[model samples]
Target chain A: MATAVNFKSEESQAELIQLVSFNLDREEYGVYVLKVREIIRMSNVTRVPNTPYYVEGVINLRGKVIPIISLRKKFSLSEKENDKQTRIIVMDVDGELMGFIVDSVSEVIRVSAGEIQPPPSVVNGGVDQEYLSGVINRADRLLVLLDLERVFSQSERESLINSSL
Target chain B: MAILCEDEELLEGFLAETSELLEKLDDDLVALEKAPEEIELLNGIFRSIHTVKGASSFLGFDLLVKITHKTEDVLNRLRKDELKVTPEIMDVVLEAVDHIKLLVNDIRNGEIVERELDEIINKLIPYISDAFRESAVLHMESAGTSEREKEVPASPVQTELETEAAAPAQERPRIEAAPAPSPQPPKPNSSKTVARGEELSDNTTVRIDVKRLDDLMNQVGEIVLERNRILQMNQDYLARENTANFGEEFSKLAKRIDFVTSELQMQVLKIRMIPVEKVFKKFPRIVRNLSRDLGKEVDLEINGEETELDRSVVDEIGDPLIHLIRNALDHGVEDPEERVAAGKPRTGKVVLSATHEGNNIIISIKDDGKGIDPEKLARKALDKGLVTEDQIAGMSGKEILDLIFLPGFSTKEKATDVSGRGVGMDVVKTNIRKLNGIIEIRSEVGKGSEFILKLPLTLAIIQSLLVDVENEVYSIPLAAVLETLKVDTSSFHVVGGQEVLKLRDSVLPLLRLQKLFGVQGSETSLNQSYVVIIGVAEKRMGLIVSRLLGQQEVAIKSLGKYLADAPGIAGSTILGDGRVALIVDPAGIIEMEESGVTGAWAA
Candidate 1:
């Protein structure tokens, strides 16, 4: 929401933007906590019959059937066996509850406005420019705050409705 | 609630009730033309219009009330046997009904129709038997219950109306519903009729928010799934473990839960079931005006108006059905003189009936008129470049009839404003297919055409036949599945680089699921494997799958924005084991094949 963006762009250190951070390959990425509904251990994901390679499948989160997207495959990152550290961070993408398979979820941290800066197109870890929102320059490492909306745009959601038709 | 809010609420209630009553009134008034002395039908018509007037006056729709009052005057005179139900009088009443519908619709949409009601009121005046006839009957009708008017003086206006028409007469405490600036409304006028009176109980049914009922259905779905999961877990443990007594008790408990959960689910689904009468009611008037416009005569016989369907289906099926009826009146049914010269009944019969066929609802519109001439349709198809002569040579009679559904292929040489614009049947086909329904056409050149539509019982949940193509499970909605086959390898032959399976004498196009979805699977499964024969209308395809997972009732859920437009995938469903499976849209698969990369199925 704009509130989270406002917190990032504001001057007050007291106003902090909360983000849930996770790993794709090596580098860390963060999405606003508001977009992250929940994070759970990866469970049984029945493969959808016909979909893009990156679309791992879908998982039943409680009773709702949610399609899952694999970040590793989507961003052309190296793949590895899913270990105990793997977590499916369920995010509300345009009101649909979709799960994102991340390496693991780290601690939820709050960063002030001045800490965030526009992302550079060529990141050292080689992440796609479209999915990056801004770089949160944390003291330990550069945290890339992802733009969930741009990653899954309105056009995609419209296709979901059209596909179901 | 605020005063204005309460007024709007009451206004909403009144509009819903009146519009429904008006819809039924349209059919009753037309029926009265044939059997003019059917007093009960006349009473039904008069009471409907009277109720609308009374409610409109109370709700302060002065214009609407006045128009309906004029309409009621004519209808009331007809009821008193002082007026004849002539075609001209029927036109005026039907016109008034249309106008009231307009005003009511506008009012329902929160717009006060500013157009003067003088034209309709004036049109109704000539039809009124005695323009100066004392409204003594309506006034005297109110005298039937002066006792109730005395009992409930809180809303003297409504109390006065309770006697004016078909009010229940026995008012018990008034219910005091719908927020009160008007203290309470009079029982909301019983918007729905009691379906049967054979087994009479208290017979009280409460109005519930449709959203609440939908929510209840979803929750019931959740409970059913949860129960299935528990039963599966217990049965597996019992089979594997050495706990004998625990197994006995657990099996018994699972059986009980299964029975209760299924009952709960069925009851919840039934709550959303509404008779298709609401959709059928407006047709008589529609046919009336249509026949009048074209100078034709049509006798619309409606059967099985009481066939119940899920409310969601009822809401959507109305438009498509209307267009089909229009088609029948325009193209299918012959003009009155033409019918007589053809040695047929003077009044063409258009039978609109709904019947429950197993899990699906089959609504057929059968017309006794000139059936479609395939040669003409084939020539039209050729002229429109919709099909080649070579394609026509290979087509069957049904395929030629099916050409009407092809876009831009209307057979009418002279385009009429009624139904021959060439866009309706295609739209009808598309809309019906959108509801996961099928539209079938059957006709003989001399005999009439019947447009049979098979629609699902509900939209949210569907019984799906789940299949596996290489370990990946896909669901084919049971509605679209024609049948299943374990076709031998010899039945499938390569024809011009495309696989065609000979199902007896007919050649069915073969769609390999793994190739369609681009799923990586063993091609060997195609040999002597399970094939789901799915069809929409005349286009049938055999979908090859690895395993048949049996049938399961799945609640359809949309894939969130990311994977929304996956071709051949309709929506996803959560299986009993809490794993997600994509619901195969058979219609979508056919559309994709036709529109995109055709013959790309060659692996």
Candidate 2:
């Protein structure tokens, strides 16, 4: 997922997609670097009662209260206790600032858009196909670019809740 | 290029000044109709028009200058006792004022105003004497020649025509070329204009861009957060102190920081305070025009124009207030003949007023017209198939009265231009709800109906008392919270599977935080739990939480569009301890409290 951004002259001519890669469970996922406002170490996230299971709760980033969702829980991966490596990536998704908890934020990398391709029909980690945008090869390993917008889309949540009701 | 830049700046100032003057002129002109002998108000109307004319002529807005001059002639005649104030003449003056307003608006868009001015001028010229008319013609001729045109004065909030007339014309314009000309041609009648113009200003104030004030407010908010972080760090220091003296010094400094930040927040909020008169000023013109058009004689009285609200609230609330006023006139007030037949006064009375009650501002529009008959409303609802006959039968008079707010509910069979298609009241409700406000209607048959719009003082930041519900923290706006106390669970009566507590004489319905938010947790029996008693207008309810946290000032942040309509959650705010807490919606809670007003409904 690459959001539009103004870049330096060198990068201007290049079809580069900058992403912040993070480790969730055993998989490495990348989201548009422009979407990430900041990355903070996992801190006290007050549990918000009566929210979806994946919404770990909210945390205070400066004076702004932003909702935090666990990426592992969101993807339905097995839940694990927070470790020293855990980081909360604060992002602005369509103007709403939110935080996503991941095992660790690896590095920010710029990859060519031409290298990235659409995902296969079924993928690893038991993640829903609708949340997957594409997969790309970085070095020798495969880097999964997550569609954060679709992952946290409201329509999907409502439909899920509607079916349960 | 410099001239172009200067012109843009001058035009911006001109628009702001003219609009403000026109708003006040509207009130004064409407008031003149009621008390034709109030010479101060007549002069007030005259001076405002004169001020507009002077500024427009200086700006080379020849069309606006010409129009206001003619309007000024009519007003001057009325001021000179050369003409009498009649309904027809008052209408002519108001119509001229209306055209002037249109011209100012047109000039604001950088377009030359070319309205049908000759017809309006012909109507106004009858009120002007020959000598005054000839002097006006001479002034217009000289206005075109640069040699005769004086150097335009530096922008003043209210410029007088006499000062413009007195300026020394310079062939070449220079920055700060001349000091303001002394008030000129001091005629005795001119003194009256002076007397009227300066009466409205007792305290000197500067007009500031609202955006700049908002930026300052936001910076102050950031300072508060920084202070909180400092306090938190100081607390950490106090917790593990190696040297007591050092800890004491740090604590004192932190406390000082806290005090200064609190004072600064107050100062910032005070600057954002705007008088409610900005909104109220436009209503008299609306009422006058509306009553005249509807063939109903209405006496619209406005009071408490001095009450202040937050700048943002003042900007938003005008249209909703206008809609309610229109509804009051169209439906609530009846025709003069109908009033006479009903043994009421021939002229209907509508009182629009504003007054602060505690932290909230209560603006009520009350009309002494044909009061809303609940029976007729019920019949209308039935005809519209909005409610079943049995449901209508079971409803109380207040409940039936509320049906007017329901969508697709219009009292008038024929749609009028004022409030068309019955969509206004529902939209009014939604708009007030957006501002965290409430609109309540009270009516008596054959009497008038009163629409009370209760609103918060400020929407951006509010002092909230944060509380813990299980593991989650939620904030209750301090303005809505009446008191917090522990109540025995045994005192709760489970009526029809819904829980309510009897607090002294009143039976208070209780909404348990866990149940309201649908928290997935098991219930535990306790002797007592902390309950925050909250009030929205006249309704009160108890919110049961696990613990009561201390109060803090919260800068409201929107939860975005997807969650905007979420029930019970107004917004989210960050706490001093670096944790996010949801700000509960008291209005929405009250709505839930009212709708599920019945025991089973609550369940």
Candidate 3:
């Protein structure tokens, strides 16, 4: 029990990383705690004209207007209806705030850096390896760590092309 | 010597005060050149330099002190009538002032680079009177000796403190030497002199950081949004409630809040308003220098310098305005001999004026010289293959003149460094369009050409006409909206595969927003739809939408870098019920229209 509590507090350790995990199409994804600003329930996003299909448009985050991206559309997964479980994970990437729509937010999970295995050459569910930082195996599920800088910076349309190929 | 002032606040204050003085000096020096014997102007110039010298000396910036001191002595001699103001003398003085500006910027940036101060200092010394030069040397030596002897080398701050105390005492002898009835030297603590006849107007204004004003504007935007929400809620409340007294009191309070919010927004916007003269200030000097360089006798007449615009607009207009004025001087103006042979005055006139027209500011640069010849422009465009002969044949005179603004178009046989290599006018047009400004050219061959720029007052907030297209709302800036009409679809005609609607005498080209944006929805009504006519420069287009959602005052917010350059969307603004609505870029849509990319209009 003492060891378990220490593992949770080990986030302050140099090699341990804390991530805010969320669900997208039954797949668990984790982004660094530092990058995740806040999670908001799905709200009305104004549709932008003449943008990529995956660009969900923009939403008013407080007084600021920030762009929203649909992770499902980005991964080429079938579109699902946004219900109570739909949440927008707002992340600060390169000083810009962008919100990503996911199925639901799970919890803040702490993991040892060694526990994260490098992503394999191929991954399931149409997600590109370029966007995956690593994969961690839990007792009953797998948590895929996402490199948001790559996921948001690299154009989704280009990634879609790579995935299709 | 390296500057080592520990107090960041004092250094910042000195930088602010001195930079403001330097800007005014640029205008004053130009005016002094035109009227060399204006004593009040001469005194103001002298006082500005003295204040700079005093402040820098306090901050222990030895290099700035040396430059401003020598320049101050020259200005003192000019004011005392010991030295005459000639082009040669003004050139050296302006050079010194420019160097001072550079040094001040260096200190502000926190890294002092080495400058060749000896060259400019040597040039300024020749303009100083012999007696003042001798006394100035004596004063410098004494001040230098006292500083070395009294202050320890370890404590630079103490030395700066002593100098700050001694700065005014040092100025007294210099002012006393100028004899009676000259402008009194400013007090020790106050480093700035009252500029000319203007009364000492301190404490009436505060020097605010622009970022703070931007924050306040954002807060006001939020307030405006909240006010809108309240108004909507009150309407719903009044409609749903049967309690008359409760509803009346709630509405009275809402009305009061609404009025207060509008006033607050206006006041905040007013704080960001600066006179266009901030940009117009540099022109006289530029004209003087460029006209002399070009050997063309030109007179620049400036009017409506007091017309105010947003500070953001003021900042961006400086470069474009300079290019336009230079174009007028270089290409539009004729040489003295040419003008005389053409039966015109030897001196060409370039009138630069600014005035408020409704919600827009109209700035025109009108030159009385060799006006643009449209036939020549057309021929050139054809040769360059920018436009074909058939296109030119169909264009009017004004449209042909606008061909100059097309990219890669230049009328000059050879590019000159003055007006830049051919890329100026298009870039100018693009920049103006970015501000939602319209640039129009009106010219008569051999008479003159006038380039009129109509710019919105502020980029932050605008009165936009909101329209709904397939359940998605968009805003069109009312400044660009000519009028909205409910037109019958059956009356529309397809001419040459392009949709057109004949409204009165003009055949207005129509573009459906739903089709343009690829909006997937059925038409609201097949019988009739709303057409919003928008005019950008000379080209007019009608935008068809499902419903007209009246007008709104919207605060524009950027869609971040990822979605920054979406083709037809300028930006997004949050609406009354916290929904984001995109602001349509009419200019961008027009570009799409010319490219034939947006699909044909649908009934």
lDDT of each: 0.74, 0.73, 0.78
Query: How does model 3 do on interface RMSD, in angstroms?
Result: 4.2
| Residue clash pairs of candidate 1 | A160-B564
Cα distance off (Å), candidate 2, residue A47: 4.2
Query: In model 1 chain B, which range of ten residues has the least summed lDDT?
Result: B195-204
Over the full model, what C-alpha lDDT does candidate 1 score relative to the true structure? 0.74
**TM-score: the better of candidates 1 and 3:** 3
Tens digit of lDDT per residue, candidate 3, span B1-603?
A: 345667655665565566667777887898899899799889878777777776776667777877876787678677768788998898888888888888876765566777767678767766766744554445444554553333223223234534554456345433423233233223344333332222111222234445546667776776777678677766767688645566676667678777767767777777678789878978888898899899999888999998988888987787779889999999899999999999999999999999999889999999998999988889989998999988898777777998988889988878888874778897787778778788889988898999999999999999999999988899999988989999789978988778899888777788989988878898565889899999775568899999999999999999887777787789889899999899999888887787676754332
- What's the lDDT for residue A153 in model 2? 73
lDDT of 3 by residue, A25-118 (tens): 8789998898889999998888876677788888998989998899999889899999999999999977899999999999999888667766
lDDT of 2 at A65: 68
Local accuracy of candidate 2 as per-residue lDDT tens digits, B1-603: 012225454555555556657756767787898899999888777767776776676676666766777787688778889898988888888888778877765554445535667677767766777755554445544544652242222112223554553232121111121123222121221111111221222122234445556666776776777678666666767687545566576667678777766767666776778789878877888899999899998888889988988988987787789898998889889999999999999989999999999778999999998788999999999999999999898777877888887878898979999875889887787678667776678999888899998888998898889897776788998877889988778788975566778888667778887777765566657898999998664456888888898898888886655444456778888766666678898877877666663233335
Model 3 misplaced stretches (Cα beyond 4 Å): A1-15, A154-165, B1-3, B129-244, B502-508, B523-527, B599-603
Query: Among all windows of ten consecutive residues in candidate 3 chain B, which has the lowest summed lDDT?
Result: B195-204
Per-candidate TM equals 0.83, 0.76, 0.84
Per-candidate iRMSD = 4.0, 3.8, 4.2
Docking class of 3: acceptable
As for TM-score, the candidate ahead, 2 or 3, is: 3
DockQ of 3: 0.48
**Residue-wise C-alpha lDDT for candidate 1, range B1-603, written one tens digit per residue:** 111335544654564455446655666787888788789888777766766766665555656755676687788677777788898988888777878877765665455647565666667766665524234234323533452332234233334564554334112112222222222223443323232211111112334445556667776776777678677767767687645566676677778677766666776777777778767887887888889899998889999998988888987898899999999999999988888998998989999999999989999999998999999999999999998999999987877888998888788879899988889988898888778898899888777999999999998889999998878888899999999988787778887677888887678878788777666756783458688999875467888888899998888888765665666777898877777888988887888777644455444
Model 1, position B213: C-alpha lDDT score = 62
TM-score, candidate 3, is: 0.84
Q: Report the error of model 3 at residue A73, Å.
A: 1.2
Candidate with more favorable, higher lDDT: 1 or 2: 1
